[model samples]
Target: MSDPVLVIGAGVAGMTAAVELADNGVQVVLVDRKSTIGGNALNLYKAFPTDDCFYCFEGNRWRPGIRKCFYRSAMIDQPNIELMTNTIIQDISGTPSKFTVKLVIGPQYVDPKKCIMCGLCVEVSEAFALESPQCQPQAVTYDPSKLDEGAKKAEQDCPTKAISLDANPSEKTITVSDIVLATGYHEMQPVAVDEYGYGVLQNVITQLELARILDPNGPLGGRLVRPSDGREAKRIMMIQCVGSRDENYYPFCSKICCVFALKHANIIANERADGRVSVVYMDIRTYDRHERYYREAREAGVEFVRGRISRVVSTEDDTLEITVYDSLLDKYLRFSIDLLVLSSALEPPEGLDEIIKTLGLKTASGYVGPADAASEDEVVVGEHVYACGGVLGPAEIPESVNQARAVVSKILQGRK
Candidate 1:
């Protein structure tokens, strides 16, 4: 029997690849360890270059013809794609064309297949409802322990009898023609850059954390406040390349950090208006079309300084003192700030070792790559495995999408 192609890590890259293949008459099984589909992109408020909102509509109400990213349940409605969230790849065996992939799938207390999503479970018991009411793969979740009274009530209340505390996790084996690994990158390791006062300082946060704070639906409700004092961050200092480009961590430049820093500066400029945003970087990398965002940031009065932070210390007055050597000025500059955001490195995701061991794949700087990249995109890694997106390296949304499509194209061509 012909099995669906398996795409691991249901990030933008994986989801795009799965959709492309499935739309082109190929069955696909998209899996991610996270309960929701969107990966790092979900945390983002806007994308660079255009500074467009990632998912929700931020357009003018009078204007028509607007489009947004897939932050909702549209993917769950696709007939050709099977989305398995909260699932992990346990082991792999057999050839790529006829591979048996072992998966450890977590139990969805309410089976989406049987769930009508009438909210009766939520009415009966709010015990295990997902954080967001707008969560994807709509199903009422329940906890066995909390459901002592609520479980039986929800079970009876549910229109489709989808609520069940007896749903136990089980190992599932799937046979697939190919495996597409799109495991995305992780945030900068703050513990490595201790001098930056990341975990040490309350207001100091990684760029990813800033993205979460900037997100309208995030914990802070898109409010720009210092994590330490809960006061509006009127003054912010952004330190670039926390882990990336540093010899101790990832030496290579993480291409996305510069633009992201600028994006944050722009946000503070627009939102706080009187906000003082200072960006200190060894070198400003606004390559190609992204230069506009850099110019916009500068025009918005966001101060750009050429320097690397030497140390970040706390002050007696509940403020952060960031010390950086300005190579351009040939002097050290100190910035007293309410919040300091570090644009850290994009390291490889977790479970990379497991992927390499189980699949016999090659890795470069923690990214999944062929034994030789020059071989071509379509070449099977070990026997029938493929990798794309940030798994191969630091890639932004556009590049990841292109890479995903490229992988699908190669797979389709090989099928014929």
Candidate 2:
């Protein structure tokens, strides 16, 4: 048998590629640095276009048109695919198809197979907590730093004997026939952008943080409340292009921010009771089929301000007073809101630079670039090396999945 294909970053894109390749009888090693696999998609409350569950993926060929929950997919039981969580690439050597990759695998404090989602550990120890209700592995995660007597007692009393406080990190070297980089993007935290008062202000947050707040399974239990005083955030304001399309930060446009911001706005206006949303954007770029989001948001009574925020002040009553210069209306506008969300730029994940250098791959605006600029297959980054999803740049889930399929096609075609 040929060496298993190594797919890095077990986000939606990497998972899709790995699952597809495995279904086609190819062996795959799917690795993720996170304790679970979903990545940013796990936090996103709803996917645009379909507005369906973010975990919903195209089911197997036998069940076409059926959307299957990724958490319950073949990833866990698939014979051809090996799932590795809490793993990172330590080093890359050799070349192309014959590459030898060294991986440092973090210790698994809780055994997923034995875990029954009983929440026994969570109740006993602050150190042990479930990441999400839909988290893959369906187990509680443990933090060594938070270890206490309660943690020790919980480990001892674990019904399934899944808790292992003595677990240690391990390293392994493996050779692969092909390498696929799906190492996703990171949501920029606009702490440096003082004008928005992101870091210093309690109610100011990034889009992803707002996503968590809106998530039914999140800490706040889907209640849109102020972080300062835990009151309902009836009035919410979103600022677009927080760190994108600017000379000081990323110059390239983060293509999906506008659509998702509008997605949030529509949800607020239509779903939440007495909720009002106002968006401030230089330009609303909901390209292609996603234009409907902007339309729907407007139709749902969501306010749109074609301008930039000039000032943000935290009032004594824990509300935010914002000033905007409306370029379209040629006037300054002022408003007070309960929540201020910044649609910050999405950038390539950290540690991608080392991987790029190791693989001798090209880059575009800090994202993985096509090896041959003139080539039709943009996913191919180098000899026997390819990229998909957010690794190439900021992409929606569907686009990322399509790119994954393209990479899978290329690999399959090359083998024949």
Candidate 3:
């Protein structure tokens, strides 16, 4: 049998590539650093352009339905795929088609196979909690730092004997026929840009945080409330280009920020009661079919200000007073808002540099770049080594899926 193909990251792109390859009679080893597989998409409530659930996707030809969700997909049950969560690449060696990888797998406190999703463990201890209702492998996770008597009791009483407090991390070395880097992007926190008052201000949050706040399964249960105080955030302000398109940080356009900001704005203006949304941006780049989002947002009475935020001050009443220099109007404006959301830059995931260095891969603005810079195919980063999704740059779900398909095609064609 041919060696298994190693697909790293386990985000939408990685999962897509792995499932496609597995269905095509190829062995796949899917690995992710997180305890669950969804990555950033897990937190996203709705995808732009389509406005469907982030997990909703067109399943493979073998699936009964045309559409399926990540949580309910064959990711965990597929026989051709070996799923590894809480694992990271420690080292990479050998040639492209025959690379040896050392992986450090984190300790598994709760065994997913034995776990029955019973609430007993979670009810008994603060340390035991479900990562998400839709989390794949469907199990409650345990936090070692919060170990207490309650945790001990829950472990002892667990119906499936899934809890293992003394579990230790182990390492494994594997050889693969091909490597696909699907390590997704991370949202910049914008804490260093103190002018935006991100970390210092309680009500100021990033787009991802806002996404979570709007999620029905989130901590607030879809309530758009101020983080500082539990009051409803009726008047919300979003500042775009928090870290991108600026020489001080990442100079490239994130490509999707403007559309997603408009998405949130439309949601708030149309769905939420008495909610008002305004966006402050240097430029609104809604390329391709996403221009509809901008139009819809405007139709919903969402205000668009072409300007930059000059100052942000927090009031004692948990309101944020923002001073904006409207470049288009050539005047300064001040407004008090319930929330200040930052459309922060999408950056390469942490430890990506180490992976790039280990694999001797090329990079563009810290993201994995194509092997042949002059080539039109961006997925192929090296011989038998490819990349897709946010690892290549800031990419939307459709684009990421397409790239993953491209990688799959390349691999299959090579074998043929």
Taking all chains together, each candidate's TM-score versus the true structure is 0.88, 0.97, 0.97
Ranking by lDDT: 2, 3, 1
What stretches of model 2 exceed 4 Å from their correct place? 58-67
lDDT of 2 by residue, 114-218 (tens): 998899889989999898776886788888999999998998999999999989999999999999999999999888889999989999998889889998888
Give the per-residue lDDT of model 3 (tens digit) for 1-416.
88899999888899889988998999999999888788888888888657877666443444754346743357887899999998989999998789999999999999999999988988989998887777886888888899889999988998889999999999999999999999999999899999988889899999999999998888889999999978889999999998999899999999989988988998899999999998998889999999999898999999989999889988889788899999999999999999999999999999999988888899999999999999999999988999999999999888888999999999999888
Ranking by TM-score: 3, 2, 1
The residue-by-residue lDDT of candidate 1 on 355-380, one tens digit each, is: 88878788777777676667765334
Q: Which has the better TM-score: candidate 1, or candidate 2?
A: 2
Better of 1 and 3 by lDDT: 3
TM-score of 3: 0.97
